[model samples]
Target: MSERFLTHQVENQPPSLLPYDAFSTDLPLREALAREGGGWAQAQVQAYGVLAGGEMMALGVQANENRPTFKPVDHYGHRIDEVEFHPAYHRLMELGTQHGVSGFAWRHADSEGAHVARAALMYLHYQADQGTSCPLTMTYACVPALQQAPELARDWLPRIVSTDYDGSHRLAWLKAGNTIGMGMTEKQGGSDVRSNTTRATPIGDGLYELVGHKWFFSAPMCDAFLVLAQAEAGLTCFLLPRFAPDGSLNAVRIQRLKNKLGDWSNASSEVEFQGAVAWRVGDEGRGVATILQMVALTRQDCLIGSAALMRQALVQAWHHVRHRRAFGRTLSEQPLMRNVIADLALESEAATALTFRVARAIDAGAFDEGEAALARVITALGKYWVCKRATPFVNEAQECLGGIGYVEDSPLPRLLRQAPLNSIWEGSGNIQCLDVLRALQREPACRAAYFRELLAARGGHVLLDAEILRLETLLGGDPTQLEGQSRLLAERMTLALQAALLIRHGDAAIADSFCQSRLGHQHGLAFGTLPAAAPTAHLLERAWPA
Candidate 1:
């Protein structure tokens, strides 16, 4: 008898389907964009989708896998204090800025669907890579703050909005296009930016000399940064450059790079400013006002980013489970697996619906105060709820893949690690919840605008109506009592808004199931506890067509 007997090893797996058009295949995204604004700048969105699905996806993987390295000194023993990255990282940066992912809305502000279309493109790009988005997002948001000082903006707006990705570390004016970073949080003061101790002494005119350390200096290689520091007029906003106007390197020293839980492809540093060259952006005591517009824009991107992460996780799970089989049946045929997938799909759709709607509101708000007020509340609301849901949603999706999902090689691990970042990036859950309360308490007109939204879907569904009634009391409650209930209020408000959108535009199956499980409380706390009324098969099929 032969001692070596061969056992059959099966390779039943889903082949890599990268380079597919993420835009065309994503059903909910297409519908949401069309409904929000019909004449979207579609060519760019489609092109980004192509890159996101194909070569860009691969580049994202390679970049993150080979994390950037810090170089304190170059070959000549000079103190360059640089962060070296793989060529793949540079390629991803070029791809993003080249396609106007960072500056599309600013450059095309007149386009009716500019905000919505940019949101769509950003949604696609987030699925490809999370790390590269840091600098890109900051660059886009910095536009609004820069507008606070038009004279200062005149010198840099053209460079900021340029679609080219000039990765050179030269002066901002010397580059074809420039990237911007931010430094608000110091070691002692985190989200408490009001307590920032970075000192800024006036150097004549609006210029200042900054001497302080930023706990988190994001995208260390960027040509410029929008920073917060203490000035003679209290906390103020300043623009700190990497190189002086005369082309010599500024006094920005990279103390060290953070070994983060995720976002490996990007470099975040602890930076020290020893009399760095700076220019004040706005009035001395009005730094907070200038920061608000930029932060609001960034927070909206956080909502969109979470939605994209959820979608990416679902796609990975759907592909793996549909192909792999055990117990003489494909995993998709399993009842419990089917329920989980359907539930995940529903949450993702709900998030997508709200994200695009708010983007439409933000675009509309340019000329309407009521719309602007509405955007303020909804943006904070969506940011909190969507970011909170992302981690759990991605975790369940990863579980659907079993042991293979836990491995480093699988994309799930990366998605899993990246999931919590958005929740913390612009602001944590508490910050977002409190901000919603701030909207309701300080801005009655904003509350009224939100109420108008709630009333639009009145009598359309009993669950929605009941939830709206509850939200009314919360919104009108005393400010002191409301702070303790911020989380609960935010969850209810966000769900109510999502339910309204689903009922108006989503399929009957998704809408009915969401109301039953979320509002009616027909099931337990965990997912997959869907009530019998759920159109499970239809939901799964719609979420991932054959």
Candidate 2:
């Protein structure tokens, strides 16, 4: 018994590091907020810090850690398309909503950097739990579309801003706070929402009856959904409520919940609307344009989401290596492991900088057309680049822990699964890259804005200077030639912007290393490939103070 009990004793392992003061420990984030004039958002940061660093995160994550179950019929066998969540999911939703993770920025619409502050909040909360952020993201995204219709906006804005998280599937009119879902992709046309087969026939007074199937209807139990369906004019935007104005259930049929590879906390379903009552959001045929208002907001969240994942993964790695020993020495003491940790830290910092920068632009974009255009482009490129980097970054971080990291019980596995969701959501990597090219080609103002951002750091660093030249060359070449190579160009543009930001705001050594390894190609392939001279210990401490 003694020998067996001794065998059960654990060896070196990482301590459970709760995410503490995500806003404070993240120096890059702090600096970015200061630049955006949101340095005063310390209160919000502290609030999130307490929640993320405590049992809230553990309970919230564990609640939905088990995938949601699709409930097609109620106890009495009446047809009811609903999704059941763990109590943890509801609490997280309540907490997130209470804190304006969805509406705080919009509510304080006059603030100098409301959007930046919101971005920061999202980044912190997502690090705590990834799946529950889905509805919060959709709720935030849906506001602009609602505003397109004064009548609708006047009616819904109050509810949208409500911090109360009402999960019941009832008339939104009766709820204190109502969450919204979205359905843009259909089976036949995924991203090409314009090709949707769902049809909307005008009933009366700008309202219509929609009949079509949505390939992916996320957060099915939401109070309402912003959906796209073909009307006589073309693909049009519509708001389909779970209950009619008279409190009758709408004819939305939930087919089945998707068996997704990850993002288990939230429910995503295949749904159909049979003459479902819906009111037009914008004008008929303005579906894509209107939905894009939502898409752009969600895209920024994707950037933040990816950064959160990266940050959490980095923290876990740093925490593990600090305690775990190998070869008679702590892993953090190992030279190669140090390099890998530093590289990951660099990536996380770059992502954070880009996310907040774009958020600042979005806030300014409200009044400045040029800045708004720039935000449009920055978000897409940032989303594509940061999200694409997240999977690999977290993967390497996971590998740092070896076998335990691969197990489902560890946070690393959940993070690894959550990493790709951002890259693939809103738009896929290819779609984002192509969209960036589209923005450049179609919106000259955006292109000019993009150039201005790059030129701000022109001559500060040799690597940035060359990367800027390469970006210009890509733009100057034939459109047809570059269109197929847009991903290549998007990658260059993303790196160039990150390099510039680092040069302007990051530490001299970190910026120098970032440019040298990322821009100058002075490093070898993979995570541990930072040059031997790189200050690995300093990087680790910067990532999370000792």
Q: Considering every candidate listed, which one attains the maximal lDDT?
A: 1
For model 2, residues 217-243, the per-residue Cα lDDT tens digits are 988988989999998888889899998
RMSD of each: 1.7, 1.4
Sliding window of 10 residues with minimal summed lDDT for model 1: 1-10
Mark the regions of model 1 whose C-alpha exceeds 4 Å error after superposition.
1-5
Clashes of each: 2, 0
Question: Per-residue alpha-carbon lDDT of model 1 for 310-345, expressed as tens digits?
Answer: 999998888888888888889988988888888888
Whole-structure CA lDDT of model 2: 0.87
Model 2 is weakest, by summed lDDT over 10 consecutive residues, at 4-13
